[model samples]
Target: MKNWLRTTLVTLFGFSLLSGLLAGCSRDHHADWSADDVAKVRDRIAGKMDLDAAQTQKLDALIAQLQVLRSDIKGTSNDPRAGFATLITGDTFDRNGAQKLLDEKTSALQQDGPQVITALADFYDSLNPDQQRKLRQKLERHKSWFGH
Candidate 1:
């Protein structure tokens, strides 16, 4: 009985350690979009596309530009729950407050939109025909997820 109990405890402890290690290995958290996260994305896409150095460099530039734009847009955002609560704190829906939030978001988009477009265009144009086709296919496969 003593030996059996010891064996069971050992097995359970080993499994628990393995499960913890495996859980830690998965680094694909989607919440925070930091520079490191964007670089990982660039690395993954670059691998998938088999990008040459020049194309990879363009991709890097595009990814960098996107990170900057994301930071800029995110800077304009506050806690959504708090913002919405403020809007509804009064008896009436604060249309003006809501409009102000919308305008801020829109302004951020307008400010960063052109630079993003340019970077995207430069990266896409740098791709050869085969790479472009692969990119289009990948986008098509994922487009439905975006409600397109």
Candidate 2:
């Protein structure tokens, strides 16, 4: 009986350690972009660009690709916000938790920003010079409201 208890304890301990390690590994690879959010952004971009059917389809695909990549990145990245969603259901706010979440977000943004920039470049490069200029203006005007 004692041996069985010891074995069960050891198994539980092993599972706990394994879970923690997997959690950390996951933080390094996730990106959080929901489908609805992706569709909305694509619609906005398409509208601003006055994209033709071909351009719209291409843009939609790009947005979908980016969204999926973002979700993957969020999964692998460590951001305090990972736990923030639960805060809404809980009774109190944990300032330390909030700070950690913010820190994670800042770190994630720093690490993943270049990838987003590269993707933007790909999209921009596909546009004609006139369209590019217009796109730039639109982006500049909305920059404040974006990335929030």
Candidate 3:
């Protein structure tokens, strides 16, 4: 019994130490993206597309537009579950209330969608045939959620 307890205790300690080390290695995803990180990603994308000066400018504009849209969407909701809770509180499902909640959420998207679309269009139109082909190839290579 003493030998068994000693081995169990040693194994538990080993696991705890290993878990701590692994947690230290893991990234803090909650941290916001820094400007340098954004720039590096932009530069990498620009390099991949072989963007000219004007094309690079357009890409930057698109990135800015996307960031704005992201901010707008993120700012719209503090707790998504809170909105749904109201709709389900009554005995019957409140269709009107649900619709209102959806509309409220979608309002931000509706407002910002046009700008995102325009920026995307401008960027795509700026790309030459080779660059467009490369972009399409890269997109096609991306795995879907179903792993196609």
Candidate 4:
């Protein structure tokens, strides 16, 4: 039971991380994404999931919250190694600095991760059995695409 719970949490975390990365990749480096941008992404995900009206609304709210969290993280990030230039310029390694960055990231995750996970799990649980099966199959197909 504990293993299953851990696996579930990890999978959900990976999904959230992948979604954030993909969203970031779609935008210009310095461009601030508007609410419409977030809405479009939420719409695309809802379409893929075949969510109903209520589900779509719930998803939209959840995505909005997550976008806020992402923005907060980006806005407060102070890592000197954030840019590629620092890596190529032979910058001195600062172990304490790295640890501080890691601590900040972990703190952010701890603060917001449970809310994201709970929203996801609630939405997933609300799916019909057939929809759940379809989702499982879709996940399996995606896994196979990466030779997992």
TM-score for each of the candidates: 0.70, 0.44, 0.65, 0.61
For candidate 3, list the clashing residue pairs, or say none.
none
lDDT (10s digit) by residue, model 3, range 28-110: 35237887888999999999889999998998899899888767655655553455567658988789997986686588799
Q: Is candidate 1 or candidate 4 better by TM-score?
A: 1
* 63-128 per-residue lDDT for model 4 (tens digits): 756765665555553432363223224566455665765677677777887887877777788778
All candidates: CA RMSD (Å): 14.6, 14.8, 12.1, 12.0
Arranged by lDDT, best first = 3, 1, 4, 2
Q: Write the per-residue lDDT of candidate 2 for residues 107-148, one digit (tens) a residue.
A: 767676766667666676678788889977877888973523
Q: Which portions of model 3 show Cα errors greater than 4 Å?
A: 1-31, 76-97, 146-148
User: Global CA lDDT of candidate 1, please?
Assistant: 0.76
Off by over 4 Å in 4: 1-32, 78-92, 144-148
The clash number for model 2 is 20
Error (Å) of candidate 2 at residue 146 is 2.5
Instruction: Name the top TM-score candidate.
Output: 1
- Residue pairs of candidate 1 with colliding backbone atoms: none
| Cα-based RMSD of candidate 2 | 14.8
